[model samples]
Target: MKISFLCILIAAIQPFLWAGAAKFGGQRSGTRYDNRAPRDTLAHLSGWPQRANWAQQNSFEAFPIFAAAVLMAYAAGVPAALIDFWAVCFIVARFAYFACYVANLATLRSLVWFAGVIACVRLMCAAI
Candidate 1:
């Protein structure tokens, strides 16, 4: 199936997040905290914000593909409203996912993931 630009956009974001990850710790030591280096291996291993950044970047990669699905619907001339609804849900879910992900809240992150899945279903239904 042909993916749309929106999907591509979502996919593109993951690498960008990865690129921004802490050189030694994702969120600290930028002269903010007294800590010279983050003690968390997650930050130092991958660097910055530790596990959160890793998870965030991992989750972030999926958006553009979802966006592509939305775009595909548009190109196929599906109703704009349907596409709009799906897009909004997708974006919101991703944001929530990111927030919960970085915070390391597994429960909320799962919910957010489900919401994104719902968005995909909605998009697929609309396209079909």
Candidate 2:
């Protein structure tokens, strides 16, 4: 498989890392996992834990666009190396985004999010 495809797999699992952070926080706080009202519980989380939940949501929101971009680029015969580079950029930006979110660096997080979006856009443009 191409490295870009591997990055897609990494992106697919990124949200789970953030979700695990949230769950870890809940465990630390002695809160039982409530399947029925999970969102309600997560909604009340504060600090890094709350940010982790938000990050997870953002990761989910970004996945489809990034995945589609990769697929489109491949289908349109974009060079594999170029696609791989941008895919790596997206992955790095996402990692930075997650770190910034957990650290409460709102401005930096937003910037990283923008970088990730740009990476996705570039990948799509390369295909066209």
Candidate 3:
């Protein structure tokens, strides 16, 4: 349940990267972005090329594991909690990965990525 809540929080806020976003108060001086797309303050820009990169990278980060988890749960007759845990991991890991990527923290990003993948694998194995 905690992970579920966190997952929703991640998903809800992520698109603010592309959508119009701004810091509420600044002398055009203190915020990373006072009047720019939130993506600009990010380590990478979000032009078409960047958006495509985001799409590809994010899909790789989350979808396959989700599909595997669902199918595995159905086929192996696993309980809902196991699948939910995997889904939660997928969501949280994506959040962590995005944060690390934006901050340009190369090493920690990979660790977070691997953790997510491992959580997915664990869920599948438990299902089976």
Q: Scored by CA lDDT, what does every candidate get? A: 0.62, 0.92, 0.56
**TM-score for every candidate vs. truth?**
0.65, 0.94, 0.55
Q: Looking at model 1, report the run of 10 residues with the lowest lDDT sum.
A: 31-40
Q: Tens digits of per-residue lDDT for model 1 on 10-76?
A: 5467545643453334445552322554334344443235555565565655655576678678877
Q: Estimate the lDDT of model 2.
A: 0.92
lDDT of 3 by residue, 21-97 (tens): 22222213244442455445433444333433353356444665556655676578666676667767777776677
Poorest stretch of ten by lDDT in candidate 3: 18-27
lDDT of 2 by residue, 8-109 (tens): 999999999998899788768776667799888888788888899999999999999999999999999998899999999999999999999999999999
Error of 3 at 108 (Å): 1.1
Off by over 4 Å in 1: 1-11, 14-48
Off by over 4 Å in 2: none
What is the Cα-based lDDT of residue 66 in candidate 1? 78
Q: Which residue segments of model 3 deviate by more than 4 Å?
A: 1-58
